[model samples]
Target: MAEFLGYENFLVAADGAVRTVRPEHLRVLPGLGEHDGEPGSCDGLTLEGVVVDVAFRGVDRVVTVDADDATGTTVRLTADVRDSALTASPGDRILLRADAAHVVALAG
Candidate 1:
């Protein structure tokens, strides 16, 4: 079942619960593995997946990532990134990291 842990930082279960995370909260990085000294490390959450789509939205590019959650269920996450900061293309494997403090669990 999906778990809820109030507002702010919360555990997202595999049971399908609405998450209140902003696209800006997601940080995209090249390659995989634990990002220890890297900014926005996995100390919060780390998602590895292939870039499915990239859409230009003004100065920011919306990157769509297809990844699996903790339960192994495929999930789609979008991250808003600046054009100068984006270096990913379709089929490129990337990592998405977000501080738990920016994640919120809503009752479903």
Candidate 2:
């Protein structure tokens, strides 16, 4: 079985020794916000990326992004945002924010 550790920004897995933050824990917003290149005052984990895909699902909008991680490697992520809240299209740059409170630990 895998052991897990939960933290404010991410989750730690025992055997794999990896940290992860799920899509549900992230918020996709248009990069045009006041905090363009940086995290907003209330953000816990912030990431800037280019929109790779966007799909409408009823009241939600599913967005996929290709963001550079701390090591400059591209990381692909998907998140669901309110349809009305996302104004970005494919090829647009956007911001992803995850609040500490929403972060959780999961078994690998």
Indicate which candidate wins on TM-score.
1
Question: Cα deviation of 13 in candidate 1 (Å)?
Answer: 3.1
Worst 10 residues of 2 by lDDT: 1-10
Runs of candidate 2 exceeding 4 Å displacement = 1-17, 36-43, 104-108
Name every residue pair that clashes in candidate 1: none
Prediction 2 global C-alpha lDDT: 0.66
Off-target runs (Cα >4 Å) in candidate 1 are 1-18
Over the stretch 14-38, how does candidate 1's per-residue lDDT look in tens digits?
A: 5566555667888888777646578
Taking the tens digit of each residue's C-alpha lDDT, what string does model 2 give over 7-103? 2223333333344566656787776565655544263557788999988888787788887656566778788777585588999988877775654
